[model samples]
Target chain A: MRRMAAIIGCGAVQVGKYPDRLESELALDAVRMALLDAGIEKGQAEGIFTTPDLRGGIGLQANLLCEYLRITPKSMAEMTCGAVAAGLTVKTAVNEIMLGQIDVAVCYGAERECSIEWFKHFGSALFEPVALQPYASYGIIWAYAMSARRYMHETGAKEEHFAMAAVRNRRNARHSPVAAFKAPIAIEDVLESRNLCSPIKLLDSSASLDGAAAVVVASAEFARRVCPKPVYIMGWGQYHDNSCIIPTDRCDKSISSFVATREAAAAAFRVAGINPEDVDVAEVYAPFSPHELIIPEDIGWFEKGEMVKAIETGETEIGGKIPVNTDGGLLSRGHPWAVTPFYQTINVVRQLRGEAGENQVPDARIGLVHCEGGMMNNVFVLILGSE
Target chain B: MSKVDFAWPASRHTPSGREFWAGLKKRKLLANKCQLCGEMFFPPRLCCPACLGDRLEWFELSGKGTLYSWTEVFFAGPEFKTPFLLGLVDLAEGVGRIASRIAGAEAGELKIGMPVRFTFVDAGEDFTIYCVTPDTG
Candidate 1:
């Protein structure tokens, strides 16, 4: 049996929809809360991993954490994995502890993502404006819209079928104290919302918001000694895909997301030695509404063209057959790019510990957390459980 | 009947647009064939990053193609006065090309994999715009 690296204490703080401009200060607040929750002194932290969005300026996140917490670890690194960054960082910290490199590590993410200049452009103009248009133009919306349109066309799914995913998530978010969009949204409201990309209205998408969350992952020995109860990292997997189109453009391979998600899910399940049904809760990243339908199938929830019935029937909602994104998901929880996955992990850890108040699933044991970056260009899947 | 402006098509041009126009003037649809792997790209590329080869050749394409996928964009930006049909047209030379406005179809009338032919129109001032029109089989 693989030696487990226990998650001693997980602390997440959601400031509000529109928070202050101080990235490092917000991050410091989260770190303080996390260390307080873990009941550990700063000097005891043996390693640190930070996932900071655009702000916190450059290369200063780890130093900032070190200065604020006064925890100078022998090893420190800042990772940028978009929404899944912190969760991946936490997994990395656990792996380090397993390797005997560090005993205690803190993984954190802080960002004021809502109002920041969200556009980023780097190098070359082979495609000019197409490659560097300001308003999230990376052919990403096109890809998602295309897949969603195809799925709808093939399955005879109505616009309401897709809107229900958002409506349900928003309703769940109403129960979440920290969710960005807490107000209830209806199918009619979503259908009438301004269309960003065709068939993908603004209401059907995740908000670009500002917030921070942090978690403490420690060695099994340290966790057993220090924390109240610890969740174990049962499995973790990640995969990559091509940056450009291939010769034969098949959706399964050319997209890379399908392959990446499948491979990661397989590897994670193998490490945990369990099937999809063993997972009581799942938090798969679905920034776009259609992806909420696509990812579950890719990860072996059900076959293709099968999610609509499942999702529409409330089987994917809280207290349903399987509780997914009971924390409202990125759809209603907001996507601050690199800070999303930490929020996802927080929910997973909460459910596993039965700490999730309003959206708790009974006797929750194993939880799966997933984060997709650049529309499945990179997928990271992690499975955690109570021992 | 309402009079519409058709004399000058509002054309946008990039380096790719400029090349596609110049080639169209010569009755040729253009593609950038990767010098190393011999793969053709409709949007044109400066280098074949796939093969890591900088050498690329401008090959005249067989304008004959079929629509791979299509969408009728109901809501459009300022540049598009009307909600027009946009399609990813696959060229006979093995490249998926993006073009605007299917010539003979109303909104929601176009189907995927329909045969199409390349058409070029003057956009005033020694310029032209390229799009795909339905091909009569």
Candidate 2:
């Protein structure tokens, strides 16, 4: 495959609770691990990119990370495009490398979201100030939960049908060392779980964890020398809607399926010069079960409302026609806020490299990794491949 | 950025919503109307999102609409009581939508597109909050 840029290395700390560890420390650890994986020293990282630290509440985190690493790079940026920031950070490096402005760039994120009450006020603030009390918007889950109802109303999907995706994602987490919840959950368990919102059970939501992940992207010329099996940045596309979670447009544009994801997926596939069937594996960011169903459908791998059958028939598991979230998605794998994209990218890269031991999809030459921010309002889709 | 600082009730209050907050206190539902484009929207904004027009007016709303969607939230911040219902509504005026707590009916009874009316209540001893209820009348 032709290279837009190439991923030389990716490293992630086991995503779980680290009540005592500062986010920067975990960030440095992940960066160092990635440098080691790429067989490059800190000096080789000519660029640094990161997302704003939500847990630490610090601005310009990438600058702080550069200070922590004690390396001055020619290019450095902090991409804060909400939940998709980590992926966009890496994509920024990919673009930088492709532009020949830098030979190597290290993009990373670290989040300690085990506490600090991740969502509420942040969700409200997304809707501007007046929404704080008047809207009662609260956390992002309410929006997704509400969307689930409209999704069922449109697709004839039952709550049980949606819970099955959670069951599948958890089942894949058993072999994943970085995953927080490796214990496989039954469909009944998901159905009986405590409801955070209607049809979205506790198991369907991500386990808030504290961890960090980093990816090193290098120019194709630089990667060919140091890294033997590089995951090439085949193509990527990004699109977003102003309707963060609860849309002013209602189901006409906001809910039934993610319009942004569909458009972004189309753009990504067009750039990759590959169709949905060509993707052997995927790591889609689905913090909730309905998102899991909506993503594959939006990606055009399955028809709308057809993800339920794909999950039940084992068509979406590892070794299936377009295996998804092989390392367990956010549902069971754990989500350390911004670090999630790095973890997902690492999983996709590893699957392409045949380094994903038990979760490996057989001969995964092409892969797709999708990231979402702000209730699927901001979407970024990347299609990667291995030569 | 506090109630003491801004004299607003919400822990995180919007500074541009003085008239909207005051109107709520007087039990009048208000939405931002773009003076130029004449577009009305909920949760008032300083600049109109439609026309980017700074000249805006506080238009009183009838508070009657249809339920667009909703949920039963069991987990949220410390301030939110568990298992409260939130509803997304489409205004009868056809201007915009609102997301707020739903009242006056059971969760099972609420359906999409059902006629709903807004009701203001004084809560937390600070300011007024609103709820969307089934408009049986």
Point out the worst 10-residue segment of candidate 2 chain B by lDDT.
Answer: B1-10
Relative to the true structure, candidate 2 reaches a TM of: 0.93
Instruction: Give candidate 1 misplaced runs (Cα > 4 Å).
Output: A1-3, A81-84, A114-139, A244-257, B1-29, B34-51, B64-86, B89-92, B95-106, B116-137
Q: Kindly list the per-residue Cα lDDT of model 1 for residues A1-387, writing each as its tens digit.
A: 133687766666663554545777777777777788889987888888888546436777789778876667977888875455776687779878878899999888877854334422221122342321111122344446655666676666677877988888888887775688888888999999987556778887776777777888888888888877788888887875643322122222323126777878888888889998888999988878777777887888888778889888888888787778887888888877687787888888888888888888899999999886655757799998887
lDDT of each: 0.70, 0.81
TM-score (C-alpha) between model 1 and the true structure: 0.84
Enumerate the candidates' DockQ scores in order: 0.19, 0.44
What TM-score, computed on C-alpha atoms, does each candidate reach? 0.84, 0.93
Q: Scoring only chain A, what TM-score does candidate 2 earn? A: 0.95
Best by lDDT: 2
What is the fnat of candidate 2?
Answer: 0.56
Encode model 2's per-residue lDDT on A1-387: one tens digit a residue.
258679999888998888788888899899999999999989889999987776556577777787787889999987787788887887888777777799999999888853337565566654563264544645778888988888887787888877888888888899987888887788899999988889788887887778799999998889898989989988888899777666763335658688889988998999889888999999999888888888899989999888867767888888676899988899888887777888999999999899999888888899898998877878999888997
* Chain A only: TM-score per candidate: 0.91, 0.95
User: Model 1 residue A104 lDDT?
Assistant: 91
